[model samples]
Target: MDFGVTPHDGLPLPPRVTICEVGPRDGLQNESAVLPVAVKAEFVERLVDAGHTVVETTSFVHPKWVPQLADAEDLFRAITLAPGVRYPVLVPNSRGLERALDLGVRDIAVFGSVTETFSRRNLGRTVGESLEMFAPVVARAREAGIGVRGYLSMCFGDPWEGEVPVPRVLDVATRMRALGCTEISLGDTIGVATPGRVAAVLDALIASGIPVDSLAVHFHDTYGQALANTLTAVRKGVTLVDASAGGLGGCPFAGSATGNLATEDLLWQLHGLGIETGVDLRKMVDTSTWLAGHLGRPSPSRTVTALAGTS
Candidate 1:
């Protein structure tokens, strides 16, 4: 577990992995308890001070679907942008992208799923149809000189559809690349994967010649397998990971699904193994503490709770 020292060389890892904190969007979106807009902004600022470079601020989705994030625009505008840090918002389509662009967002993430059944249920479009629709969206963002990231949800098992084929996941990744998405994040939407399965999926994707460096992993902790899956992806050369503070979110569509891996837990694991995240653990725990207070529930992160003496 010592990433700093190997069993053979006893030397530290050359570089640590980068973590993309998505609590503001993915974490907050599914909370049944609504937090004040100002509070949400405060939580985001705290995360920045805690050393997160990329904080997913909010999503431009409709409030009707996700009532928890009704104040997406206001929250985005209110957040104190940290120096040397990037705030990426989740923009579903042209409308979402336009809203972000109006708010002066420089980087935005467009989301789509890998499975046809999940795609139709979650996005109201087929996988191919979604890719075709993103063509112009990516074109507009590129013309505006904005950075674009594509998210492929349900990369592992799906609730609606039992298990997702690796080939199907790769096909979606290939389409995202073709749509001008520089980064493709494979999401374990239902958290139904183990390390061996994670390696198999990424291996299939990499074997198809997709640059491993261009891939990221987003996992849920439904089965408490997200961390193991993340380690597998890291060993496979994936450089970016998506996590949420306090593990505060869940999927609305995926039944009984949980939030993304807590930022604190992942950092704890990474730091224990000598992986440098550049994040302040104490500050992250503080933010999670405050956010959990707003929701009147303890954080789902074992690391956060244990450190806060609330577990």
Candidate 2:
């Protein structure tokens, strides 16, 4: 199904923007307190009912590294799977893919980095090596009739290298797509991207003849630029976007990276612009609110607080 990102005249926005929420996986990955499996399942269900069609459910990695997601299998099993909604989980390697397949998951995501430093630190491999590692996994996934999405981290900026050039990101993106990835998500892992730079990168790709449909945007709001950056992408004819509810996830490798853009905030902005996200702003807010109450804190989504403040 085409995520409705058709171009509209004179407007700096797409006709449709599909938000693939990663709060359940990316948002919760770094938290010290482990949420109960039941709580997480309930949260995802409410989100789906609220109109999130694509949810990043969990990561299939070693528990030793990310202890918070140890119950990945349990969480995947417990969630009452919805028919129309698609749930994609991050699988670090073949072992992760096996785990996902064991549960009969329909979609899976693989990740790699454009920078050598990021690749080494995050996955203990070089950028080229990481792609090589995912080659078979991607191939097998396609053969199994499951969908694959590739996350290209540090596409715009790198923590150690700094100011990643567009050419480097392009190379990785091409390789990932060739590996059978359905959507190549360019991630501003540290949220250092600005609107101009985001457009420049996307434009560069278009010049390279990569269709925008198979692309998604993932931004971190560290400098409060994720929304603006996302809007810029929308204007450029890109459709699929990745966001987290309540700005839950932050990049563990990059200092001061912040979390992904808040789902509620993005919805608020998109709705105002007359671009449909098919997400119920109130239900999204409520799910995050429920989680926040259990965690004993307020949400990080400024839009959620500003608009729903009276409630």
Candidate 3:
């Protein structure tokens, strides 16, 4: 498949892309085992050493909800923060925001859902109610000089509510942007989005006045369409993409939502298309390999699997 092409206007792809590594947080959150703070810190540091600038270190949610990341504060304090590298944590509400702020975190991300069922199931609120909840969180984060990224989950299709419309996703995204989120990441949580669906959503978002630069794409490889969907988004001029090192995480709410788009897998496609991600593929492979050992399993990333076989 020819994955390189501007889907519209025949424009050249961006010179560089930003890959946000969400392994430490999103990747491990759904795992059955909880890694110790020291190991988690080491995993993050290795990712930074591998050249990821925006690494999502952890989430500030309640420990009972995501016990895997219960040591968010300790993990954040233990990691060595390098200059020019961002450590963004996921803050689900004002309480999470407060926790992040207490640790002097500069960047945080908030999540919202397009479908009513997902919002209610994932956040214990309706769609409108969830946005209302995020309003104060985003406002206070901005007041505290924190950069907020918004995540809209189940953008393409919801397991409970199948075939979500683009406008519904755009509506929530627009409100998120208005809530002062610096960027919005459209998440295909169930991995049901194909390349055409991905392109359609991006086109609708861009056409609705959302700057392509302010948008990011997050895909799960459950159905093996992540790279293709990513390519479609890039062709639509998106610059920021989310991936997990070693393809670690899945959505606990969505039963079928499996492994995330792997950092190594996304890098392979981006590098092949001549798009600079400022990431060392070899180093990423090694990091994924090391992480897989810690997880006591082989990496789900095709690139990591292939490279490991050859190495």
lDDT of 3 by residue, 105-206 (tens): 999999889999999999999989998999999999999988999999999999988999988988888888999999999999999999999988988889
Q: Give the Å error, residue 272, model 3.
A: 0.8
Q: On a 0 to 100 scale, what is the lDDT of residue 201 in model 2?
A: 91
Candidate 3, overall lDDT? 0.90
Candidate 2 local lDDT, residue 81: 92
lDDT, candidates in the order shown: 0.86, 0.88, 0.90
When superposed on Cα atoms, how far off is each prediction in RMSD?
2.4, 3.4, 2.6
Q: How well does candidate 2 match the true structure in TM-score terms?
A: 0.95
Taking the tens digit of each residue's C-alpha lDDT, what string does model 1 give over 110-196? 889898888899889998888887888888998998888899998888887888888888888998988888789999998898998
lDDT of 2 by residue, 1-311 (tens): 12234445666666688999999999998676799999889988988999999999999989988888999999999999999989999999998999999999999999899999989999999988999999989998999999999999998888789899988888888888888899989999999999989998999888887889988999999898999999899888888999988888897767768888999888877887778889988888888888888667788899667655545
Clashing pairs in model 1, backbone N/Cα/C closer than 3 A = 3-273
Error of 2 at 239 (Å): 0.9
lDDT accuracy of residue 296 in candidate 2: 73
The deviation in Å at residue 171 for candidate 2 is: 0.9
